[model samples]
Target chain A: MTPSHSGPSDRLEASLAGFDVPAARPPDFPTADVSYAVDDTPIGRMLLACDGSGVLVASLFTPDAAAEEAALQRLAARISPRVLRRPQSLDEARRWLESYLDGGRPGAAPAWALSLATPFQIPVLTTLAARVGYGDRATYGQLASWAGRPQAARAVGTALGGNPLCVVLPCHRVVGASGSLTGYAGGLAAKRYLLELESTSL
Target chain B: MTLPPFQLLVDAHWRDVARLAHALVGPDDGDDVAQQAWLQAWAAYPSLTSATNLRGWLFTVTYRCATDAHRGRGRRPVPVEDPSLAAAERPAVDPPATASDESGVWQIVATLPPRQREAVALRYVADLDHAAIAAALGTSTAMSRRLVSDALGSLRKALS
Candidate 1:
């Protein structure tokens, strides 16, 4: 179907000159069972995913393309594989995130989807969210005790390491047993930045 | 090779895929077919071995979805409203006076046998090369060339 071919194909192409297929709008497209967005923030590039109702996961530090793909693959396996990047759908979450990162108090917290969390991890994360406030820090041992597993400080660290909600769930607020900055999925630098951000906001 | 973000794929080829869907199934079912194609593509994307021929991959998916829509058409209830009414409601761009003649050409293209119609659409509408068309249609490159030539022959005869 070379355009230079001066014959029936050209004539056919000419006849189709004015034929137009309407451009599709975002709403006209089907809703992905899971929609995601990536944003660059003060700390690092973050990957966020949500079902229509609530956020499924947020990666505070998306270091590379492979990390993004890994998060997407996990979402596809656990939820539905029908995922698309629709940033407009995530405006509210972004706004809240920006506000929180800027050291300003955000409005109502975004809804969370804990489907990715194990049962123990769920309780551990819930305790962290409820008991830990902004500008306040808790030791891992304290968090484990608060979650009713006083002997499971090591388990609590493992759970927070895989926190699906990241900053939104306040996992960064949990410090080491001795109150030193320690392992965070986003790395220690991000954890320190988050901690300092909260302390200065006080 | 590391896979690129899925969003990039959607951004790059959505318009082409939409146009292909319209060419295959007409405007009424075009959006539905395209949506199904994208959803399926997303689901299968992570496991995709190569991102090298993504456009061809997308067109292939759209073709399969269009075919499925055709097969299921008889099982689905027919729309009670006039199809023209539905077309009128669509957000069509401003068409020139030659719009009717253009549509007449598409009508001719549509009546061709399925393979020929697909070949014509992939060639003219989607603006894909013979090799890309072959990849999408699962045909040999020589076969795709023959299909397009035969389809154009039919179009020329009908137009004359």
Candidate 2:
């Protein structure tokens, strides 16, 4: 009897592998309120998350695993702990994104989940998402005024700095007062790239 | 080190948990047991101090859940079917010819005593080391090795 050799244990391992286990479904409760996925876009690998109702949540440019993990932790802390990485679940957001990045306008605005935003950031981001088009650019002061907070340009800038939905909310479209490209979550180079992409398509 | 995102844990171990559940319980109850284990794990995740052996910790949770499920259903003997008949009766895609043989092995595994069954599942299904299996099963490392060896002996004898 080959006690340590490939026998019963080996057979058992192969048998176990033969069982057809389905993918675990997302938990039913709010604990798993957010589903996320990472996809490679023209800019970089971007992490996209959606709430239970399929509202678009965080869309951060994650260059590496550490960045993706950090964004996921932030979402879990701010939204719900039951965040699962289900890529197929984020299909609509990904489709919209792919279309937009391909220089074609997505049909409609995907619902945004601003759970990570403040009361102030909400209106600022909402205004930006609704008013800014694919190739349009606006100054931070113009965005603040559009959001009906004329005196809060700096606050608007701060709000855009922490924008949860990067490309979806068009944070890159908000430039410095003199039309110079300002800071972007994906960095200055990405901001320039996005701007160039939009300009070339237009 | 800080707790990594709970999603990472789910992504890494959900399949192992499901497979362990099926081995401990049966196919009918496996999904429910795995789901229960993940929910419980999520609830208790914040208090988990060490992330070093999360696989062991996850299997421990799954084992407890499977045991609870068994107790809830009054510990009825999981019905065993004739392997050839079971394989032939599957209406889905045609299973490879070896599937019947594999299912026969699984049926033998399913008939072991509870502790030996768990030892076998953790050892082969989850692919954990003896020490890790011991940690999940709350037994000594020597005890884990003995349980697995005894179970393998039973399997070989039964298969022969």
Give candidates' CA RMSD values in order: 8.5, 7.6
I-RMSD for candidate 1: 5.3
* lDDT of the structure predicted as candidate 1: 0.74
Best by DockQ: 2
> TM-score per candidate, in order?
0.63, 0.65
Each predicted model: what fraction of the native A–B Cα contacts (within 8 Å) does it retain?
Answer: 0.27, 0.36
Model 2 Cα shift for residue A171 (angstroms)? 1.4
Could you say which candidate leads in TM-score? 2
Q: Candidate 1 DockQ category?
A: incorrect
Pairs clashing within candidate 2: A31-A82, A32-A82
lDDT of 2 at A184: 88
For model 2, report the TM-score of its A chain.
0.80
lDDT of 1 by residue, A1-202 (tens): 4648676666667766445565664313356667888988887889888885656565445778888877877776677655678788788888899998898866678887687778999999998989998888899999999999999999899999989888989898888867888889888888888889888877
